[model samples]
Target chain A: MMNCKEATQLLSEKLDRPLDTKEKVMLGVHTAMCSSCKQFGRQMEDIRSLAKQYSKGKQTEEKK
Target chain B: MIEANPSLSASEAPNAALFYDQEFMESLRSQMVKFATLQVQDAQLAEDAVQEAMLSAYQNIDKFGRQAALKTWVFSILKNKLIDLLRKEKRTTVASQLENGPNLQGDALMDHLFKENGHWQKSERPQKWDDPDHGVENEHFWRVFDACLTALPEKYGRFFMMREFLEMATPEICHNEDISVSSLNVTLYRARLRLRECLEDNWYQAKESGS
Candidate 1:
């Protein structure tokens, strides 16, 4: 089982690209057991989504 | 607001509805200039690049197939211009060294939060910033977010913009940066870690304290 440290690292990496099967399984198991890492994963997703929107400013909204 | 300003597009091209409208173009220019300034870190140079981008975009408006939003297409043009600017600056500035050198401080900061056993210290565990609408709806939240991003190391901030804002693929980033994929990942990981910590301190925690 990957530790929280390794699991968190994978969580960030998975944002940039797809994890391999082994990495996905390990992260899945680790996050399943670790609430902190799970929260970290969610936050990372939020940051990614928010950053994308924020970086583009309100252009997307104006277009709509 | 733009739709209400019908005079802005009354005498413009048929594609004026697609962003050629004067008022819309003015707003887009300012936004593009702001975005470019963040990436370039120089207001004057950012404005110049935005100008070039706007000219190119206008000249090639017919080439636009409407397959993508006008803003996306225009931003892509601006991004290409910014990349060109960065490439030029890379030769004359310290950007090459910053990109190639070890980010020792980023590593030390991360290590300070975790232990030898690869676990977060009780004091350092990530906290929930549970406001779901903070990033989406609140304009003030973005000001704080921008401050946190500005606090990052310059190279890291630039890299983050390339990957996230410009929507460049990792492989393309690696090739353009002349770094290995693993190296790029490490840089990006450290950038996120630092931004997360900074935002937690300046935005989330501050909000909690105020409330």
Candidate 2:
């Protein structure tokens, strides 16, 4: 079974692109069983969303 | 004297209508310098880029034709200038930067966080962060975030920004940097790990205690 460290690494890779079928199932299983990795997934999502808003904030400043 | 329309709110004013005038370019000057400084990491170079961008924009003012937001048009010019500066730096400082090239030495830090079996070390497991929405509302949080980004090794920092802020694709980044796709992925992953840890320690943990 993939451990937390490996699973979290895959989570970051997923951020860059879509995971293949086998990697997807394995990450799904690891995250489903592990609350910590699940939380880490949410955090990556938060960071990416924050990046969008961060740049948008700069654009808003550009307007003035 | 013409009377202003008191009924129309300030927010109702259109930015596009102002693009052709010098007034809008003047307003963007400081903000452009601020953004360029973050990207290029030097106050003098950033100012040069901003000045060059603005001057070029003014010279080509007629070509603007109000087709885009003045801000977007001017910022793209600034981006080009910054890239030109980077290429210049690349040519002149190849020897010094050879040591600073994209590297995977971040593995030492990762090994410390994870054991041989790949489980997270007890001391290194990620803690639950503070409420993210409220966290973003705090100006101090962004200050810390910027500090964390600046702390990253220069190459990793630029690569991360190219991917995150500039939103470049993996292949595009690899081709531009002349690195393998796998190496780029590893570098990006390590960059995220370091950044996340830094932000958690400096911002989120501090928030947990303050509240």
Candidate 3:
């Protein structure tokens, strides 16, 4: 089994939907228990959400 | 959304709209522009790169092979155009490293990846959820979220733009960049790791400020 860091590393791959069943379950279980990994997952989402916003904002600016 | 074509004149090739749908092209406009921006590092030039690449694809739509997705093919052309622009402008351009500022200079290995002033300039944490029972929207959350992204590493910044903003798939990304799948995955992992750390640090700070 991978440690917290290793599992955290795979979190992006999981986010990308490239992980297999066992890997997915392992990361899910790990993030469930690991505080840092949980934080990481949230940040991954935060960055993405913001990036989308920035793109949209820029799009709007261009329209104006 | 591109409507699939239901009819074509006999002997007329299904190449033009097949290679790219007009409405889909409109949706992909900003995405291509964003991808070119990160690659070329200049907004105007990036726009030019995207325009040139799109035109080139349109002209040679019939030559596009099925080996790559149309998006990937367009991105490849944009990448080539960016490289060409970089070469032409190399003699005049300054070598300023791209950054979001709060410049932290250190010889330490780990410290090189972060800034000294810390993530968010403003410490308000936004509301993650909206409730009809409770009062309105959570605007603060968006502010903190934007700050976290501005704090990640530059390489990760472009990678994030290419994948999330441009909407390219992992397999296509690997093929376009000519990088191994594992390397691309590792790059994404590190990018996510940095972003995760930045978000956690700010979320706690926001709580501190709110309290």
CA RMSD per model (angstroms): 6.5, 8.0, 11.7
Regarding lDDT, does 1 or 3 come out ahead? Answer: 1
Q: Which residue pairs collide in model 2, if any?
A: none
Docking class of 2: acceptable
Q: Is the docking of candidate 3 incorrect, acceptable, medium or high quality?
A: incorrect
Model 1 Cα shift for residue B54 (angstroms): 4.8
DockQ winner: 1
User: Share of real interface contacts recovered by each model?
Assistant: 0.53, 0.44, 0.27
- Greater DockQ among 1 and 3 belongs to 1
Residue-wise C-alpha lDDT for candidate 3, range B90-115, written one tens digit per residue:
42222124433342211231234322
Chain A TM-scores, candidates in order: 0.84, 0.85, 0.70
Worst 10 residues of 2 chain B by lDDT: B1-10
Give the residue spans of candidate 2 off by over 4 A: A58-64, B1-48, B54-77, B80-105
Give the alpha-carbon lDDT of every model.
Answer: 0.74, 0.70, 0.56
